[model samples]
Target: MKSKVKPLPAEQKEEIATSEPLPAYASEEGIDPELLETARVRLELLYGEVAADWPGFIARPGQYQMMQAALLTFLSAKAPEDADRSGRQLAQLEAGTGTGKTVAYCLAAIVASEILKKPVVVSTATVALQEQLFQKDLPRLAKIIPDLRFDILKGRARYVCQSRLEGVINDVAQDMLPGDMFQDAFIDTRRQQEVIPRDRGQAMRWFKSTEKKLNNGSWDGDVDSLAQTPDPQDWRQVQANAHACNGGRCEFFKSCAFFKARRQAAGATLQVANHALILATLQNESTLIDAGNTLFVFDEAHHLPSIAAEQFSYRARIGTSSKLLTSLRTVALRHGKTLPASTRPDPVAFAQLITGCTDKLSVLERFWIDAGLVSAEKDVHRFTQGEIPQDLIPECEELANLLGSVNRTVERIAEALMEQDESLSVSERDEQTRAGVELGVYVSRLGTLEKLMRSWATHDKIPWAKWLEWVEDAGGTNIDAWLCASPMTAAQVLSKNLWKTVSAAVCTSATLTACGSFDFFDRMSGMNRFPERRSLVVDSPFDYATQGELRIAPMKHSPKNSEFSGELCLKLPGLLLAHEHGQLVLFTSRKQMQACHAALPAALEKQVLMQGVLSRVELLKEHSRRVKQGERSIIFGLQSFGEGIDLPGELCEHVVIDKLPFTPPNSPVEEALSEWLGTQGRDPFLELSVPRTGMKLAQWAGRGVRTVTDRAVITICDTRLISMRYGQALLDGMPPFPVVRPRA
Candidate 1:
């Protein structure tokens, strides 16, 4: 039998996770005329202030043009009751580096928000950039634009959970529990294991030290505000979790640190947040953010697709049900006795629920193994093109139904716990509060399991891919398989969540366009869904031709060939010494990066900083220190160092790339997407592969010349630039540098 699936409508523009007229698009109605008039006047006055109030602030025509595009696009979308409308917002800008982009977007979004009466939630791809905007740029703008208020906000995990802190402080002097009492509540208990620290000395020291700072009014409870960053293991105990919070019922409610910051954020005219947290807040349905009413400004907007994919992705392990069932048995045995007889969840029912889930999970494991989908030998295997081979659809559908029933049972258990919490006597308030919070956690897990199973069984759902893969446990143990589902494109996620629902939005980035067009991004990001979308490309003011040279080495092998790593490792040391000042060698894979780092000469290794050896901050600090001491320094890094890393002038005189940054040859999602595209008669290599590689190449070269006068040479150790058919297009996409071809 065929699996039940949601069929796409004939005129459906794209496949979305939901069929509801979910959020999207722009409308020309409901704008406040008077507010727009006032904003228009403010823009003129702000233009004069930009040239006057800030030091050395040049009024680049491109910057003004960007602001104009933002204003016009938003004004065109202004409408009353936009949250319920079917309009798609269409404002895309490619403002290259050094175009004063932050200032341009801030002014435009601020003025537009004033007219639309919406908060401008500026989402960035990195915390460093978010901090830079909040600390450096907004304050500069506030000086010139009166009453321009902004707040830098992050996820609750970024703040110290006051209750958890108090608990840790109380136990600081106590000898370690039988198991060290380092219990961590995992949001997804199926896959994530609780970390057990070997020692608590560091954790206690950090807590005591932080408590002293807080008492003396030196620390503000922010993880970033601490003088010394807490060790990640130490921070885990104090990080906020939905499972731990008791809200107003807790004694610490009045002094809650995260909520105070959240309050300030909600009231601010603008909010600076990283993309992940912004998506988290929305997915969590936090009252602090009004997704439909707020105007989202996506900075580093090219990252939207990957970020959204990660946010929307769901995974469930085969053994999770058994583990959770066992945990539930313990909960009922130990804690169920505390509840009032009338309110207690029936032990029989709970057992049945747990047993049913466990049995169903076994059935799933057997089905996958029987269908030859998983192997005891292969460490990792993905479902081909995210499709359930014809013979397996029946088993998948049965598993889907079992999951739905399990989800319902989980909900009932939560409801029982919540009911008990609501009926608690004054003396039982705290105890019930804790139980209610636990219930909240179970409900979340139930939703995750149900959603993934539903998406997997729904064969014809548009743009959602499913995969089954596993990694062998350490010490040659059992392989743990993960059932995963993710949206093929982020555009649909954004369109339904941000674009269609919000009154207006502006997506700005340094490198949004790939292969000299926005079509790749447009298709991937659902920009085509917007009723009336407009895009603007403001080139960088820097003269790339005068500043940098592109040097392509005649390599004996491509990255696809086994000999490439050894050849590059041998050549990099001499090039590192030749550069003298500072250079960054970027690798496409960690295996390659670590191999090259290990193979470097002992003397040269001291001056070479490798990723994973230290924190990014420490590495940058060490690099700067070496450069300041007038010593040669080089950094060996992965794809992360390709973009958003700034090293101008002598700090970075050269950048060497070991290979092109191409998507994996067999990524299930990409393959599934390419297959779908081909069904529509599109070229996968040109449309999907080339543009992604070109953009990464551009970002890699972009690291060398951060300033207008900065001079550097970019060394690419691949000969494919002149040898392969599509190599020239990728090379052309990099900054326009003088080319130097090595003799064969």
Candidate 2:
């Protein structure tokens, strides 16, 4: 009997056929078959060269096929016009983690850009990946393909402003007074004093020494590396006194590291950058480096929408006004300037503005507090009716009026400062000017509150309440709150910005589809409506059935009870002891992680590594060393440890999750989102939470199996996996394995 290969799924076959097609222009030109074959041979030879140079690295089967598909899609889009007239096309490819996806994508992008006479923009989610591409992959590729061009573009904050550094040094030398009295008051506190010393001369000396070592030239312009910690006072001085950067106008523009890097990017065939900068470019229509003829490659593309939301979200706090007041006072006191008591700009007026805003915010907060109280007083069964107390309307109206008044006052002050004459001395005028700019920014943010108030009053989606609270900060306790209306979906806000406007886009990630369906990711990303768009889900080539085992431990009680963490802590030590170390125990909540850390036996505690207390790299290194030394150890981490962590062989033999990590429905933001989705007649449970949790569970499970030869056991202790209907979705998302029920 002959061995038989399994047939490809209908969907997979369609994806392969549709992903590529012969370029129309190439066909019109009647390109010779020999020439096309020669080009293909050259591409293979280039990849072979890379493999020969890197002794252990080899391209997996079908990797080239994926690359060809990516290239053909890109080239087809560019066939109609000159590079200048072609609109960029988006194509998503789903290649699993061990598929050498990065190299395949990079190779395809390079070839497509060259063939079509265009550039390629590659964007990724994390800096670690950015580093991997720039430091490891790109350089290796460049060595093999000598003509390839590439450059890395980081956000503006990554680079140090030469003028700003000089200004900070000068300000420290002059013993400049503190910018904010509130900050001055905290100077005596242990945290503040220890982090930022009082000796101005010493601080300046330290900065100068560090600056010299850097030679005032580093790509990305980040100042963090030069100092042990960021100093707010130093940053303020730098912002106020630094020379204006005119891009190409500066005398130092030629040797200027940032500009030099940008120039290099302009000439490169491929450019790598972060999501924020890329989105900002698209929103503003200003490509950092002319991408007129470029195909954008978005890596870890699932994060694009969330990152875009964060970029567009507005935030404001009570101390913004207080800080402005303090800065204004410092300038006035130094200039010996006194204005007429009635109409003159006084620092107290600014403070009063903040006080009035806080008072108004307090009213809104009280309304919510009373609402919570009323809900508590209602019959338990009546809670489902979703009625708002009629008494809260007047308070909401009054608070909205107060916020409006505060916004106007700030805007008026900003106008006066902007209209002021420029004849004043640098010290006399600069601080006030900056303060005015900041006030304008806040005035715009206050609009969010106004919008929230309107939505709440009208009950746009669902009945919800807005609230605020005074929270402690390093300066002092300050107010921050949600201008929240009942739960709203991020999809509602993101759909217009991300989904509708783009002519074409490709979203690729290792974990996008859940339970063999892309519906979950599509809904969350606001891409569900594009049913005609192409998608693919390629499985990891690693054989997980051989490399890993799934074990579900039986539990006697629910995980929701208060004593669950303690119980888990008690149960974990024996498991760790049996496994003989190299264990990673993940928890959904910080409180649980802390309780487990505290409850572990002293000997076990000594061998356990916990998150929050140490950096990720440090924790991983310590775990690796302990496992190498043959000591049993457990590493406890939260969501940060879920994905992107790779540990093969004995370094990881057991993976344990405390429970399913679901977004807490009570969280103000999530609650608002859920309520909004409910109003839209969508199943919030299946559409919003289940898929998100399922994706996370899959990511966490992936940490266990990294290589074909690796083997480990995964234990999900939560009883819900067996009891809940949605548990099947989570289980189906995982690699296929035989189920085993442990003896109670």
TM-score of each: 0.83, 0.73
lDDT of 1 by residue, 304-336 (tens): 888887898887777654466556555543455
Candidate 2 positional error at 522, Å: 0.9
Please report, in order, the local distance difference test score of every candidate based on alpha carbons: 0.72, 0.60
Q: Report the Cα lDDT for candidate 1.
A: 0.72
Off by over 4 Å in 1: 1-38, 78-88, 164-196, 200-219, 227-238, 329-347, 369-376, 389-427, 461-463, 471-479, 554-580, 589-615, 626-632, 674-681, 740-744
lDDT of 2 by residue, 1-744 (tens): 322222234465456445446332112122244544544555555566665664466555545555655554454443323332222243456666677777777876676566557677788886668767877788878886889888887755455555446546655222323345333322213234344445787667766864575474442344434436456555444431112343443334565555666777778887888777776665545646444345767789877766765554432333343353344335433322322234345456545655655565566556544454322233111112133445555655664565676566556565555444457676545444444443444454455555445544555434433333233445645432223343234454445554444323456777777765777766666665544345555556777767777877766656877666667878877767778858888888898888878877898889888997789899899989988998876789999898888887787888988888887676445555666567778887887688888878888887777766777888888878777898888888876655555676
**TM-score of predicted model 2?**
0.73
Strongest candidate by TM-score: 1
